[model samples]
Structures are given as C-alpha cells and as structure tokens.
Target: MKNTMAEDKIVADKTIATKVIEKLREDIINNRFETGSRITIKEISERYGVSPMPVREAFRTLEGEHLLEINPYKGATVLRIDEQFVRDVYGVLRALECLLYETALDEIDQGVIQKLRCINEQIRAIVDLPYGAAEYVDLNTKFHSTIMEHSKNQKALEMYTHYHEIISTIRKKYIPVPERIRTGIEQHEKLIEALEKKDVLLVKMAVDEHIKSALENFMTQFSQGK
Candidate 1:
C-alpha cells in the first residue's frame, strides 16, 4: 500500500507539473507577465492551486525557452525583449518565408488558397470589430501564422512558429497603435490579392515589406517608450 501510494503521488505530480508548464508557457507568450517582472513559484502555486513543486517545474521549462530567467535566491523574472533577438528572428523568417513562397508557387493547391482566404476573412472581421490591445495582438498573430501554415515546409514552419512566439512576446509589451493595425490589414488584403494571382514575386515583396514596416514601427515605439 505504501509503494502504491508513492507511485500515485508521482503520477499526480507529473500531471500537475505538465498543466502548470502549459499555462505558464501561454501566459509568457501572450505577455500576461510584463518583461522583467518577478514570477515566484509560490505565487504561481497559489494562483493555480497547485503545489510549489509543479510551479518550479513550470519555471524551469519556461527558462529553457528563454522566456524566463531564473537566478538562485532571486527567483525568476520575465526575459527582456532584445532588439538583436528580434532582428535574428525576422532575418530567419524572411528567408524561410521567401523560400516557402518560391516552393509553394509550383505546388500550392486550391484547398490551401481557399483556407488562406478564409483566414483573411476572419482577420478582416476581427479588425472591423471594437477590440482592445490584446484582441488586436491575437488577431495579428493568427493572420501571419495562417499564411505560414500553407507553406507546407515542415522545417520552415517550425522555425516560423518559434519566431512568431518571440514576436508575440515583444508585441505585448509595445502594443501596435491603431494606425499600424489598419496598415497591416491593408497589407494583408494586398497579399491575398497577390496570392490569388499566383505571383510569387509579388507575394514575397509584400511579405518582406510588411515585416520591415512592423520592425520599424516596433523600434519607433521602443524609442518613444509607448
């Protein structure tokens, strides 16, 4: 009976840790925790109604993703968004996205195009609605992720997803202004038009321009402390 009870406790501990890790991951990516804010294992345990062990496990997991920085005797804090990190992410993304477009030009099926169109419509509807900063951020991520999904390059897709996760974290800190959102919507519409025409060159140019514009906007906001 003692041994059985110990095994059950271990299983329960693992389950709780997994749940905590997942929740913390989402919170960090969604920017619920501000950069440089301290996150205590005890606080997370209380918030999630779990034991400290699970919360500690969660922190370790997030630390591995560079989303959290853990210091002995000091606890964990959200990682700062570095401009170099953003440049590295976007640099890789541009190359992969361009490659995806080039390869997809020859292989993009009707089904994929239809799915992309559907996502664009959803983004359009979201933009038209009265939304808060958080809603706009979420919609903006969905819009870019949807395009990557149709690229059909598994390695490129994985890298793009990771890059977007980093970008999402940054966006939460400096929410894009309403004007940027409007410009993004217009750019999305134009990209869709380019896709419809099956013009890979046009699609690549539009994507690169859109990413560059976003990077510039982010830098401007960072400088202004918005």
Candidate 2:
C-alpha cells in the first residue's frame, strides 16, 4: 500500500506540474508577466498553490521554450527582447510564407479567402478604439494562423507555428502604432486580392512585403522607444 501510494503521488505531481506549466505558458505568451520581470519558484508555487517541485519543473519547461532565463542564484527572468532574434525570425517567416502561398495557391478556396477578409474587416473596425493594440495583435495572429492552416503542408505548418510563438512575444512588447496598423490592414487586403485572383507570385510578394514592412516598423519603434 505504501509503494502504491508513492507511485500515485508521483503521477499526481507530474500532472500538477504539467498543468502549472501550461497555465504559466499562457500567461507568459499573453504578456501577463511584464517584460524583463523575474519569476521566482516560491511565488509561482504560492500563486498556483502547488509544491516547489512543480514550480521548478514549470520554470524548466518555460526555459526550454526560450521564454525564461534561469540564473544560478537570481532565479528566472523573462527573456529580454532581442532585435536580431526578431529579424531572423521574420526573415524565415517571410520565406516560409512565400513558399506556403505558392504551394497553397491551387488548394486555397474561396471560403478561406472570405474568412480571412472577414477577420481583416473586424480588425479594421477595432483599430481606433481603446485597447485596440491588443485586439489587433490577436486578430493578426488569427489571420496568419488561418492562412497557414489552409497551406496543407504539415511540416511548413509546424515550422510556422514555432516562429509565430516567438513573434508573439516580440509583438506584445512593441504593439504597432495606428499608422502601421492601418498599413497592415491595407496589406492584408491586398493579400486577399492576390489570393482571390489565384496569382501565386502576387500573393507571395504581398506576403513578403507585409511582413517586411511590419518588421521594419517594429524595429524602428523599438529603437526609438515609442
């Protein structure tokens, strides 16, 4: 009975740790933890009402995701924004998005294009309101994710998701300004036009330009501390 109980406890601990990790991951991705903030195991354990072991395990998992940096005595701090990291990620994303557009041109249907158009329109409607930055960010993610889903390339989808996770972190720190937001909407509309026309070359160019322009704007703001 003692051995059986110990095994059950171990299993429970693992489950609890996984749950904590997932919850914390969401919080981090959602920018709940302020940029450059430290995350202590004790605080996490207290907040989640879990043991230190689970909190530590959760931290380790986040660390692996490049979302946290663990110091020997200082505990964990959210990773700082790296401009080069964003540049490299966006570069890769541009290339992959172009490839996805080409491959998905024939496979993409009117329904998917219409869905994207709706999302874009919704994004436009909210661009001038309070908290519009956050809403735009979410809508932008949904728009790109929807496109990737229709790409029908499992490997490409996986790669895109990985890059997207990192990009989400960067975006939270530097939400685009109103002008950039307007430009992004325009670019998205052009992308939809390209898709509707089934012009693979045009779609690819539009996607690349959209991403490149966004990246440039983000880097400029990041440098200027806007």
Candidate 3:
C-alpha cells in the first residue's frame, strides 16, 4: 500500500510539473517576462495555482532548455540573449538547413513545390492578423520542413529539429515585429522560384542570402534591445 501511494504521488507531481513547464515556456517565449528578470517559485506557484514543488520542477526543466537560468542566490531568471547568441543559433540553423535543402533538392517534385506554395500562401494570409504571428511562424516552419523532409538523413533531421526548437522561442519573442514576417515571405517566394526553375545552384544561393539577411535583421533587433 505504501509503495502504491508513493507511485501515485510521483505521478501527481509529474503531472503538475508538466503543466507548469508548458505555461512557463509559453509565457517566456511570448515575452510575458522580460529578459534577465527574476522568477521565483512562490510567484509562479501563486500565479499558476500550483504548489511550489511543481514550479521548482518546471524551473529545472526550463533551465535545461536554455530558457531560464537558475542562480545560487537569486532563484531562476530569464537568460539574457545577446547578439552573439543570436548569430550562433541562426548560424547553426543556416548550416543545417542548407545541407538539408541541398540533399533534398533532386528528390523534390512538382507536388512538393505546390505544397510549399500553399503553406506560403497561408503564412501571408495570417501575417496581418492581430493574433496571427504564432500561426504565421508555424506555417513558415511547415513550409521549410516540407522541403527538408526529403533529405532522408535521420541524423541531419534530428539536429535540425533540436535547432528549430531552440530558435522557435526566439521567433515567438519577436513575433510581434512585422518586418521579419514580410521579409520571410519575400525570401520564400524566391526559393520557390528557384525550385521551379530546377536550378539547384540558384536554390542554394537564395537560401544562403535569405539566412544572411535573417541573421542581420535578427541581430539588428537584438542590438536595439527590442
């Protein structure tokens, strides 16, 4: 009976901890908490209507994900993102994404191109909506993932997925900025055009430029502390 009771308690704690993690992650990504701001277990527990244990578990998880920092004396704080961090994250993305695109190029067909076009259209449709930034970002991810799926390289795909998750929070942080959305749409169009022409070199060049431009824009935003 004691063993069963302990197991149940563990399960209950895990369930609450999972909920806390999800809510905190969303709030952090959505910029509800400012960078470098301290977050305490008591505050999160009261805010989310959970006990301190669950909030503490969630903090450990977030710290592992690079979303929060656990200080010895100050509790958990949102990590301060810098220009170098932006460059490094995006640089890894560009490297992985370019390799995926190149490997997937010849395997791409008319149907894949059509699918990408539809996703691009969906992205454009949501860009101007008041609450559409998240949806827009999701659709954009789908568009790129579609092309990358053809790579058939399990290791590359896994690496890309990890990198994607890391940068996704960054995207959520800046989702309210419209210029990035607009520029992404333009770059997508160019990439699709290159694919239609069956010009692999052109596709590579376009992707290179797109990633460089995105890095520049992201760094510009980070430097301005926006």
State the lDDT of candidate 2 residue by residue for 1-226, as single tens digits. 1122222232343589777776676567656677788878887776666789988998887787677999877879987546775688789888888887777778678899889999999999999999899899889889877777767678987787767666765566676688998999999999999988999888988998899899899889777763
Instruction: For model 1, state the Cα shift of residue 89 in Å.
Output: 2.1
Pairs clashing within candidate 2: none
In model 1, the clashing pairs are none
Task: Return whichever of 1 and 2 wins on TM-score.
Answer: 2
Per-residue lDDT over 47-138 for candidate 1, one digit per residue giving the tens place of the 0 to 100 score: 66778998888888778767799988778989865666567767877888787766566555677667667765666566646664457677
List ranges where model 2 is wrong by over 4 Å: 1-81
Worst lDDT run of 10 residues, candidate 1, spans 1-10
Candidate number of the best lDDT: 2
- In order, what is each prediction's RMSD in angstroms? 7.8, 7.9, 7.5
lDDT of each: 0.71, 0.79, 0.78
Local accuracy of candidate 3 as per-residue lDDT tens digits, 47-163: 777789988888988887677989876789897656676678788888887788878888889999999999988888888889777787678778898998899677988988866
Backbone clash pairs in model 3 (N, Cα, C under 3 Å; residues 3+ apart or in different chains), count: 0
Candidate 3's C-alpha runs over 4 A off are 1-80
Find the candidate with the highest TM-score and give its number: 2
| Backbone clash total, candidate 2 | 0
